[model samples]
Target: METSSVLIINLLVWFLLLANVLSFSTFEKLVLPPSVTGPESASFDRGGEGPYVTVADGRILKWKGPSVGFVDFAYTSPNRTKIACDGTNDLKFGPICGRPLALSFNYKTSDLYITDAFFGLLVVGFNGGLATQLSGGYKYLSGIDVESYTGNVYMTDASLTSDSTGRLLKYDPRTQRVTVLLSGLSGGGGPAVSSSRNYVLVPDYINKKIQRYWLQGPKKETTEVFLTDCGSPKTIKRAVNDGEFWVAVEKQVQQQPVLTEPQGLRVNGSAVVLQTVPLTQFSDMTLAVVQESNDALYVGSSYTDFVGVYKN
Candidate 1:
């Protein structure tokens, strides 16, 4: 049978069966928890330490010391305050962001670029103004990050194909062109670009690895492994102060754990430890971390719908 004919027949049967059913579940029917409440004035330490704040609601989780900051898609820290941008979950654009999962700041432009799961990308002014969309009709964009050298944007298309593959795209505002930089990356998502614009660190979600690519050289020779079998880091962001990057691995155990939960890794000063500081109740779909002017840290999680905070 022709593909269209087969699809029509399947649709007819599905509609008939669904019509006979009393209640049906839909994407909208899926229940998302009420947003977590955040703190009015969350506290943090001076040097790389603090508690984690749930971005959407701003629920503060205190610790013996400080925690790491990871803000997903919420308002930025307005004057060193970590704010979450709870994006829209409309179906037409909702599935694209899955949770509006990108966080990046352009110091030169003083603008924040966020990739809402429902909308492609939203550009908001740092000084507070209208937030606008940057792209449209993308299957899924996991996270957004900027290149320090040229102030260009890079993001991930988690999957829109049969192979469960993903690709990287460059957003050139001058030309308003979104071009695919690399493709066929198995489960590629969460991009972190180097300050000098030399390399990009990407998390291979399905492959359980972190890969780096040279942006200047030929595309074919660019892909290289930064860390393989590195738990299952879902999202990554470059540290603001240092050139090192941080990755949020979903979980340590696939089904059941024998040891610690998966943690974030900071590539800095020849020191990398599987952090014990828990950032999310569930492994956040993306790790949205940024450095604040006050030297604190903020992180975000899609599953929890809150931004986690830590003192930097």
Candidate 2:
């Protein structure tokens, strides 16, 4: 996702969210430590312990209530030095210090999987430290999700430098091998495996579409356009309430800095848009993640020092 001017969110509006929402308000704000920014994506452990977020400095931070604030959880680069990498946005340091973009936990094993724009895919244990690299040559890896049932890792590669024709990849833990499941994708956002584990919804930033890539059933190993009207969809997250998905979208030109009508959408697997929240009113922030945890929505920006918690 792209960065925008840092803005505090104040969502003072009312609407029927999935016809179940009663009120819309900011529940709380999780402010990051000074200097560092970009809580690009978040995840919780199997024990329901976190809203752990990845920052721009190539490290992951965990929230432990208001008193403890955010503590150092993990980092991707073994060569990274805090003096050179912390709070910096220099692209030249990406390969040297690593820039972790997305993360998902294997709840079954308590291992966290991470995708760095320069470090490929890596995993760390429950006791956080330097993560171990799993696979390499996966540059610009955007989103990642692990199927806790089988330990199969699903991720996307936005092959921007090569052809801009992205791909969907899967990693089998048993064989320690990576497989290309689908190709010809825009592949900018993270993917969501369905609640039933039948298929995964993948977002295309180039095509402006969300396609269903089947995992099982008669339609297994096939792909279909699940959504198209979503504006440059970024990250798709599953709701804890009903397994429905919440997506973050932005109306901005390619490589543009200014954003317009950024929104968060609650959509079903059938591609139905259940509810839409215009994010411009909430914050001037251009979000990359709108995740649902319990009855609240966690909105994340790549350049903000705080993560906004919206409730209904």
Estimate, for each residue in 275-305, the C-alpha lDDT of model 1 and write its tens digit.
Answer: 3334433352444443232333444444444
lDDT of 2 at 255: 45
The weakest ten consecutive residues by lDDT in model 1 span 22-31
Highest-lDDT candidate? 2
lDDT of 2 by residue, 17-124 (tens): 334454345456799888878888878888877688888888898989889988889999999988898888676998777888888999889999999988899999
What is the TM-score of each predicted model, taking all chains together? Answer: 0.62, 0.88
What is candidate 1's CA lDDT for residue 35?
A: 46
Superposition-based RMSD of candidate 1 using all C-alpha atoms, in angstroms: 18.8
The per-model lDDT (C-alpha) reads 0.53, 0.82
TM-score (C-alpha) between model 2 and the true structure:
0.88
